[model samples]
Target: MRSAIHEFPDDLFTNNERKSGAVLLHITATLYMFLALAITCDEYFVTSLEKICEKLDLSEDVAGATFMAAGSSAPELFASVIGVFITHGDVGVGTIVGSAVFNILCIIGVCGIFAGQVVVLTWWAVFRDSSYYTLSVVALIAFIYDEKIVWWESLVLVIMYAGYILVMKFNSSMQRFFMGKSSKNVANGNAATSSEMEDVKPSKAYSRGSVVMVDEMMNASPSKFRFPEAGLRVMVTSHFGPKTRLRMASRLIITERQKLVQAANGVETQVIDGKVEIENGTVPEDKPTEAEENDTISPFHIPRGVGSKIKWLISWPLLLLLFFTVPNCAKPRWEKYFMLSFILSTVWIAVFSYLMVWMVTIIGYTLGIPDVIMGITFLAAGTSVPDCIASLIVARQGLGDMAVSNTIGSNVFDILVGLGVPWAMQTMCVNYGSEVMINSRGLVYSVVLLLGSVALTVLGIHINKWQLDFKLGVYVIVLYAVFLCFSIMIEYNVFTFVNLPMCMEE
Candidate 1:
């Protein structure tokens, strides 16, 4: 008895091709592993943030609004500041302001629309989180106006955050009672209840469907079936079930037999001794019914949309050019050009930064708006963009808790990491004899940031049952109003706090 295995032909091109394919596969696998690691790190960061927020006993809203939001946003903040420093301040200022505007007008606005639809801000969300955000903005402006952040000023910020936390802690006790009351009020006030629970259930149902689909797909194919078009044949079996299984098998055999007939046409046939076998089988005519005849027209011939057409027009040519030119471009001279392009691009980015600041200043002057007002607006919006992106992404992923947790985590990180890192860096750079002139602007910004955090904490404590109430929103708005008024007074040099002048002394 001979062995069933047959040796594959050995050829120079064949071995070379196999070796090349193996090398390509190895490289692809390594690249994929690295990419996976990077993504895992990002996810780990998010998870760590959540743990920190929970440990601090912060509510999801507070955690997200402050910590995770700020921490994840660190990259953008660092980038903006670097841009500012690189461009001798103007670009940095513009980058920060431009980013802020992008966050508020684009990111937040879009998120608000989605969030509003996702969790209809039951008057409470609007009052508590929304209102506090508004107030935080106002307080931030006040700090900017003072143009100096004394130790007391920093203490005030810490105090505000502490107050909010205390309020929330107290509110936690009354949460159940308020929740009951709110539920009862909602029941009485409206016929329709837009519960998040409804969304939760459907997702669970979809998960179950996915599991079933996987099982069915795996079992549908047979181990022995090796048709020329095996994938297409298997798909047909999956569609029609067991009743059409045999027919599909027969059709596959017929298709392969036809191809063999075409390849071995006009070959001589002979019957020898006791054996009788045809050298070439007759090609069966595949006569079509009306429906089958109509099906001869390829389904793939369907017209695509204008957008798809445009994309294809651009992509195909670009792909071909890339395919032809990339090897040449990878050479040393071309590589240097690529490096130069990157450097030039960074410089161009700085130019955009300067242009942005100049535009904002020009517009502010034309509108008779104060520079302090512009600065405050820029910082508040700039800082808050990361929060908006984090919140929206988390909310969309159905991890609202994580999102909220992340914000809180980021806030803590910003205070401990963000501010601390910068301060440490600055301190290290300063020599003992060289007066470490603390930039009053940075100090003021820090104070405002702390104050906003504190206010949120206090509001959280005051609210019953960890629930954000509308009253908090009112408080936020009022706090913001006071801050703005004080800011205006300070900007005009009409106010003084603890012997420090209100406005910046040119």
Candidate 2:
């Protein structure tokens, strides 16, 4: 099928007159897609997500599992839509499958290796998310096994996601039901431990035992902390996930860091009741502080260092483009128009996703690469960067459960909502009773491998005593490398000819 975005006949290789230019354009298109996704996710998508959470008074756990997951997984969803409707191939499925593996193996691996110390995970949280994720993957494998998806199958996937959402909605209840403990007791214990630890200095590094201690202290109860002036926290306590809490902590750190920068340039700092406060900005009676207002777009500002300057300079065009096109919900001016920002960001994500798929399909065709292979490799990694970065950040903060749950939970969203919605639209609505075809048999193998990766990762974490550290990181990373190798080889017919050779013009 000819791509709607392709200007060249057949592919870049088919036309000598503009072959080189076409190739370069496609390459640039792919890179631009990455930049576009990153900008949209960071600046607009997540900020809008926070706004929705605040507006709806949703819990952090529910919001993170649903809105945050959906927001971050938007690109993959759109890519799957493009793959099914436009490309009529396996690219979308391949991307989702590959991305699932990457999320499970590669991201966790990186977090483990670079998190600076052992970070103990909450077993129940990991188990809950991973179990649901496994079922989702299994459902995907079952649906795609025969290389066709019918209306009912798509419906099943969508319904499965609905069930997952419901589970997240009652996460605390489920935790209590399964763990045999009420959240109130846990919450109370957490409050006492947190207050005691408030005066203690954070240790430089955590050993395995210290990691367990930290995990116990942190997981003892839901945090009652609120950043009222920062405007990130809600009234919800037990619902806060590690990711949400970590972001709040990051906001405070950023404020302190900003104050330090200001002090270096001669801004005065005041010590009030043994706490350091900057005099440059004051928290308004009801309005968010300067730090809260710039929470999302703070990095867009030109900073004081050469490397940071260069990075900001490179990102300036994207920043400017997004700034004009989408409302910045984090800004005081557009604070109330978060829904508008969410809609606009989602639209941009769809556009970027379409361009990404279109370019990758053409490039693969030109270079004689199978769509599945391109999808599994390039598209997967490109789309998953946001999740990877988020997981790594939280992991470094010693929010191992948050990091692990995010990775696994996003996979669930990707498999169920990301792929499911598109399939449902095609079969149930777009063309009634129609079936979407899976172009490559290799994708089934890849998905099975994806399931295996999840099992192995969970097993590895369990074996490591639920601690994410350097050894487990290396293990999962090696698993990721091995997965990529096997997937590529399978697509290339090294093990079996499951995919047809890309048709090329002479």
Candidate 3:
């Protein structure tokens, strides 16, 4: 008899049915974990967090810096907690390091590639976030240098985070001070640039050159592309932040959904190049009023196509479970009890994180891969999905600063809060005068690579004239690939042996 289990090779089985079943279980668990995280974050966690911010009357900058960063980073944080108390390994730290690299390089690379148009970033926001993030990374490296964390070192990380929050609180004044002196010079430079652009006309309508010219115009003055929607022409002008534009776009999308009956009746609505265009010259007078928009509850969308339907069917069980367990705070009835929603959503996040880490750990063990490698690659990427989605949405809306700031700022949160809270709990609460051990020395090298990735990314953006576009996208993506390769090699001792072989069953 031969056994099919990779980790338990000595066991004999009559057939491979058991192995097939095990593989199926792994796949099922992985998919369910991602589905649970996605639903919890998008529907419950984010909505409840927003309401909490409103209730607390936190400023937009503060909310974005603190709670919003936490909301997007909840999974990584929970994963770190599980790593500390449950697994007692470096998985949590590795995940944070990998996720930081992913957020800075991969997310920015994605934004630059898929944003559909070149978006200019404000230098002050980038510099502010990046400088603080670099310091956080340096602090993390210093704390973990000996592969052990004492109570005070963890406390330092927490205190540094508090300082970051204060910096965000005073962000406006700082930004003004930084830009005040150069404001006039920038204005004059912009005038010269626009005049220079005016002299360069497109030679052909359908040529690549012509498209670039049109993109430049759109980047310079988006108001020219404004179209009437819901009896109002909402223009995403140069002065408007991408966040504001995103809100307006969401309202337009909702209003358009209300007018779907008009499209069914006689008005032809076609989705052309990702834009909903009306064929009729006249606008529909019957639009959803402000009250109606305010009262709209989230609609359950049954996606079209056989493949999509199958996915939806598979995800239905998890969706139903969450719907019953967690209160939907976005609804008007449960809206007041957002705190409850936040707490419940958080509990679910922990549960899901535990399951995800457990599955990944088992998978790594079965494959003879180190826990740090698993954490750095699969676990890191999986847990960072929410942050990736949020950044991409803002990037597409032409809010490059918000998108870039979000990626960098979330790195700070992941490093300081995600890793700090757990270490603090273990050292201070779990047992006084105790230290948490980092089993792998490779992680230090990975963190160093993480710091370099940030510098390269910021330098790349600067060299590209602060434009998020195809070229910059390619550059940063290459850097991400190199980072992953080096980290994996470092863990495997390809360059230097830093990890022990996994224990195998004989």
User: Largest lDDT belongs to which candidate?
Assistant: 2
| C-alpha positional error of residue 24 in candidate 1 after TM-score superposition, expressed in Å | 53
lDDT of each: 0.34, 0.72, 0.70
Best by TM-score: 2
TM-score of 2: 0.83
Candidate 1 local lDDT, 250-325, one digit each (tens): 2333333333343357533221223122111111223222123222222222224586465445334423433232
Candidate 3 stretches greater than 4 Å from native: 1-21, 181-311
Clashing pairs in 3: none
Candidate 2 global CA lDDT score? 0.72
TM-score against truth, every candidate: 0.35, 0.83, 0.78
Model 3: weakest 10-residue lDDT segment is 184-193
Rank candidates by TM-score, best first: 2, 3, 1
